[model samples]
Target: MNIVYSSSDSYAPIAGVSIMSLLHNNTDADEINIYMIDNNISDENKKRFENMVDKFGRNIVFIPRPDLNKMSGVDIEVGRWNISTFFRLFLCTILPDNLDRCIYLDCDTVVRHSLREFWETDLEDKIVAAVDDCRSDRYKTELNLPCDSTYTNNGVLLIDLKSWREMNVEKDFLDFIIAHNGNITYVDQGVLNGVLAKKNLVKVIHTKYDAMTVFFDFNFKDLMKVRRPEHHLSEEEYIEAVTDPYIIHYTSCFLSGTRPWNENNNHPFVGDYLKYKSMSPWKDFPQYPDVRKKSKKMMTSVCNAMPKRMMIAGISLVHSKLYPMVRSLKGKRRG
Candidate 1:
């Protein structure tokens, strides 16, 4: 199996933990070829990654990050995400031609099961397969996609390089970016969904493959109420995903600066991340202070400590009553 990750020096330790987890969990697989889209990672970090992979009897290929300025016709403003995020876009251009398929995992993930099943999943003539984004319909509207279209999270992708090459996907992606330069909200993710979802080219995979933090943190009923209608995970599937997730995408927590490695984070999966970190080469890595302010942490703690029923009721009232009234008042103010 071919696994790809993109990271820079700043995120190398976190990326190392993710890679270690992948290697640790998928020992049953016959072979695992790891590839990293390098963003000038320091030699020390590279050695650390090498040691971690070597310990697992696996090897990694470091593909140099492509110059986006040279690759794209228009300048891409990579917001909160690093330039390495754009590296996935140019996999076909950067990787060797003989490599036909690869599984792309974001650095903010930890694998919890053998990926043989996921790695062997058939793309069914699609260029890529991914989990449906939690906010699928919102993304659809943001990108002006059809209501029935699937908006996928690019975090976990099973990519078919042959299809990408044959269909000139690279050119299409560049063209899309140039055409919709300033309109993109989620950087490369938005561009990917905008281009591919419109063509009906993305295969929607099981959520377990990219089980996000929101899957565990949010009430399932509340989640369903807010989710797009096109996200068609059955209750059974949803339960299976939450109960037996293969990959934990610490996406929301990571973005909110409440990642497990942060001192103030109390995310449920922080223990899981710490477990992997203890086993990794960076076992002694220190947790940094939380990026979230102390006041926010206190507020979050108070809210989290609320009784489940009360919490749900409060959220429901806010969504069903307060939010609509606030919108109405804003409209009246405009009038």
Candidate 2:
């Protein structure tokens, strides 16, 4: 499977760690290549990442983009123009050409199961596969879009690169940003939804494929059964669930005050995060301190400024606590 990710210096270590988790746990893939692009990375950090991939038995394609430092844009929440504008260049041009189709994952996710299901499933000629954000229904109506599964999270994409290029998607998407002068919520994601909606070029993949921490309100266990139907797991079913996820998107990094990696956060996946961290080669890298600091700052800013729904927060907290108990009970039942 071809995997793609874009991160700046602040995220390469974690992205490298995430890639390692994918390689170690996902056995179904014949080969996995991580396409990582970072312009701001220190040579030391870059070398550390390379060494980590080397030790972990995965192929790494590292692209260094020195020219990206000049771009700038407002982060809106921080009241300062941050440097995420460079991602536009990545979305438009810098990607590699070896793969006709690719799975684009944010650096924050850890794959618990083979992504073969996502990569192998036909897109039915659609350019991408994504899930609608739970909160974006209101935004969709405001934008005059039909209230279907239209507001998608771009964090996990099953991209049909050929279709993306054939449809001139990148150019048209960039033009939309240019026309709007880069003022939009959620950056590239919002513009992507604006451009792709009703175009018959996007397919709504199973939400289980990208089970975001932000939207845990729905009956996901049921949804999982329905989509990958006939595969039902009772509350006592422990191994079955862990062994079969398509992707475990740790989108909590996108939320403020809510990450397992943070010192004072109650993230559901804290144990799992630590598990991956313990196996990471960054344990020996000298830049660990710097990486942790930047990761904390990024997650803090995102969570603090994001709009909160009390119900969602409550459910998330409950799920975090309940899941382990449920898993324990499932194990007993299975035994």
TM-score of each: 0.86, 0.70
RMSD per candidate (Å) reads 4.7, 11.4
lDDT of 1 by residue, 173-192 (tens): 88777766523556788778
The best candidate in terms of lDDT? 1
Q: Candidate 2 versus the native: TM-score?
A: 0.70
lDDT of 2 by residue, 1-335 (tens): 77877777767666766776777777667787777766577787778777776775777776665343233222222112234433532443666665688878877777776777778878886778886554424344333356663667776888878777767776666565555455544556666777786565677766566656643322445333212222222433323233344566666433434554445655555566567767886655432222345766775565455554443364344343343345335434533
Worst 10 residues of 1 by lDDT: 326-335
At residue 25, what lDDT does model 1 achieve? 91
The backbone clash count of each candidate, in order, is 0, 4
Error of 2 at 234 (Å): 17
Clashing pairs in 2: 236-330, 255-303, 256-303, 256-304
Candidate 1's C-alpha lDDT? 0.79
